[model samples]
Target: MTSIKTKKILSKAGYYIFVSLLAFAMCYPLIWMLCSSFKETNTIFATATSLIPDPFVLKNYPNGWKGFGGISFATFFKNSGFVTVLSTIGIVASSTVTAYGFARIRFPGSKIWFSCMLLSMMIPFQVLMVPQYMMFNLFGWTGTYLPLIVPSFFINGFGIFLTVQFIKGIPRDLDEAAKIDGCSTYTIFLRIIVPLIVPAMVTNGIFAFIGKWDDFMSALLYLNKPQQYTLALALKLFCDPSSTSDWGAMFAMAILSLIPVFLIFAFFQKYLVEGISASGLKG
Candidate 1:
């Protein structure tokens, strides 16, 4: 019995060690980027395998923040924050209402409409990009943030579907009780269904924030001015393969750009996992 227990303990230790090694392997690139950010640009490529910076310099942060075309990194941060916050709010608000309507209300062609919405998700965004660009261009919104922000208010197929599934898991008895108390459909949705689907809303908001924050293609296509650029676009400015590049500054800014996303996920990961799992199960 003692020998068997000893074997089990050894197996567990081996498993944990293997997992730790695997995790480190997966994380090595990020680790190397962080380490290289402190080293001088010339030394970055020379010490590719080294995780420790022999002569670390703090100039990368200041230099990167200085930015190209006289636009600072601060502008990019502010732009990203504005877009992300608004887009998140819009998605959660619109999707919750739409999801509530689909999940609870019985209207003509409701199932057909919902089916169509779900079907739209399978269609790749690239296929629609050209037509969308042309439409926005006709509206004279190509040079502004409207092209990026406005569409979010209309509909997000995934957000609506996620929320509808979660809302369906809610007990219908609550809606009945609210109605018997003379509550209108909107009131019942606000008072009963909205409160119950907080997890799904949060999940949608997190996804929206991440998507908007990391959005490069839309910004690239619509935004022509330097002041309108996002963090992703600003990072691209660090690279000019046609000429000299500031590798150190680029790495530093890249590391800094990841901080917000990392913190958000670290703090709200439980809600994300819980929301997705619960909604998926209900569906």
Candidate 2:
């Protein structure tokens, strides 16, 4: 019995070690990018195997800030911020209201509508991309942020689904109590439901923020004007096939672009975890 217990402990330890190594491997690229960003162009090639830069440089940052053709990093940052903030707010507010209706309120065709919502999630964004682009073109919204920001007002299927799951976890007794106090449905949603599901809101908000921040293809396809480009699009400008790429500056910008996302995640990480956990528990 003693021998068996010892073997089990060793097996668990081995499993943990394997998992840790796997996690490190998965994260290695991000670590490499961060280190490479601080290195000079020649130094990067020299210290290819080393994680730490032997000679660090801060010039890459300013170089990256002034991207190709004098396009400023400030412009990209501002554009991205505008789109991300508007989209995040829209997604959170719309998704919350839609999720509340689906989770708690009974209405005609609610079940069918809910099923349709799930079905929408199964449809690939690629399938819709061309049609969406055509629609935007028809409205002459191309080369602007409208194509990116406008759709966010409509509740995203995944956000709605996730929020619904979290909302379901909240006790209906709260809704009933609110009703007894002569609270309207909208008031109940505002005063009670919104507060209770703040964790899920944070989770969804973080996801939306990240999605907008990292969006590359949409920005590439829709934004024709360099001045209106997001960070993702701006990063691609650093890669010049005509000459050797400014890899150090490119990586530097990439690292700097992640700062806002990191700050957001750090701020709301606890709520995000709680929201996800609570949703699963309810489901």
Candidate 3:
């Protein structure tokens, strides 16, 4: 019994040590970026291997915030916030309704439509980008936020799938009970389903928020004016292969850019984990 107990202790210690090293490996890039942000741009590459900056300059934050073309990083942040918030709302609202229909309602061709949605998930966004760009250009939406914000109103396949799985876990007896009380389908969804599916909704909302916040491609393709640039686009302004690049400023801003996402994840981490686990197990 003593030998067995010692073996278990050794196993647990080995597991924790392995996990700690793995975590550090994964986090090293971010840590390096943070340290590099305070170093001089020229020395950044020279001492790239080092985690600690020899002489940490405080100018990077101020200089980066100054931004390019007389536009501050604040504008970029505002634009990102606008797009992310609206896109998240659109995702949650549209996906929730669609998931409800797919999960709870029995209609002709419902299964077929759900299958099509699943199939849609298999198709990469790159395949549709050209056609979408052409269509948006024809609509004169290439330079506008419409192209970025409009498509989010439609069914988000992953979000719908996640919500549907979560909704499936909910007892159907609740729906029947609501119906017996003379509640309409819409009424039941609003009053009964929505409240119970909070975890799934929060999960989808967090995913949507992160996706929109980190979306560089869509923003780059749609927005042309520097004033209308998102934070991701603004980051590009710091890089110029043909000329001097403010590596320090870029890294500083990049670190600052991560704060919102980090804070969000830290706060909603419990819900995110619970939602994903519950959805996976239930649906």
Best by TM-score: 3
Instruction: By TM-score, rank the candidates, best first.
Output: 3, 1, 2
| lDDT of candidate 3 at residue 51, scale 0 to 100 | 79
- The list of candidate 3 runs beyond 4 A from truth reads none
Over 101-191, each residue of candidate 2 has an lDDT whose tens digit, in order, gives: 9999999999999999999989998999999999999999999899899999995998999999999888889989989999999999999
lDDT of candidate 3 over 75-132, digit per residue (tens): 9999999988999999999999999999999999999999999998899989988999
- Least well predicted 10-residue stretch by lDDT in candidate 2: 63-72
Pitting candidate 2 against candidate 3, the one with the higher lDDT is 3
Off by over 4 Å in 2: 1-19, 43-47
TM-score each candidate.
0.96, 0.92, 0.98
lDDT of candidate model 1 versus the reference: 0.91
Pairing residues by index, what is the TM-score of model 2? 0.92
Candidate 1 TM-score to native:
0.96
Candidate 1 residue runs with Cα over 4 Å from true position:
none
Candidate 2 residue 17 Cα shift, in angstroms, is 4.3
lDDT to native, each model: 0.91, 0.92, 0.94
Q: Give candidates' CA RMSD values in order.
A: 1.3, 2.3, 1.0
